[model samples]
Target: MSDEHSPLIPASYDIVWSIVTVLIIALTIVALVTLARSARRLTATQALIWTVVVLFIPFLGPAAWLTIGRGGVPVERT
Candidate 1:
């Protein structure tokens, strides 16, 4: 295809996508670490189930652990 007719991708857009991908990977790593720590605090069976969930379910697993599997509500801090 001629350069004029080919689809063009701006450099800035490519950089933005690269940055976003890196950020997503970093966040996933952080979530996995958090899940591991939280799992350690639970009983053996609970930890096993949570580990399975977090490892197999990707985003939803970690999110669930943070919201529903972290035991209970946090105390307010001033």
Candidate 2:
């Protein structure tokens, strides 16, 4: 038998996956933090619903929150 070995997955693939995972996690965290801080923008029920969306749907959820869901008429402050 020949002494040779090869990996089914390349090292680059692992690196790419690691980067992707980190990005997704970071996106989720940022989305949640922004959601929490925007208390005036969302009511308790709305915030809860958005939290569920952001947590359950992963990439698309957070992306949607940052883009569409988070947008609205700006609240005027005294």
Q: All candidates: CA RMSD in angstroms?
A: 5.5, 3.5
- What are the TM-scores, per candidate, against the unseen true structure? 0.52, 0.81
Instruction: Encode model 2's per-residue lDDT on 1-78: one tens digit a residue.
Output: 974445787778889999999999999999999888786667888889889999999899999999988785255587
C-alpha-based local distance difference test score of model 1: 0.68
Candidate 2 lDDT trough over 10 residues, lowest sum: 69-78
- Model 2 stretches astray by more than 4 angstroms: 1-6
In candidate 2, residue 34 scores what lDDT? Answer: 86
Report the Cα lDDT for residue 3, model 2.
45
**Which runs in model 1 stand beyond 4 Å of their true positions?**
1-7, 43-64, 71-78
lDDT of 1 by residue, 1-78 (tens): 656432576777878988876765665576667766665467788778877876677567767776787655243355
Q: After superposition, how far is residue 51 of candidate 2 from its true place, in Å?
A: 0.4
Note the Cα lDDT for every prediction shown: 0.68, 0.86
Top model number, TM-score? 2
> Best candidate per lDDT, number?
2
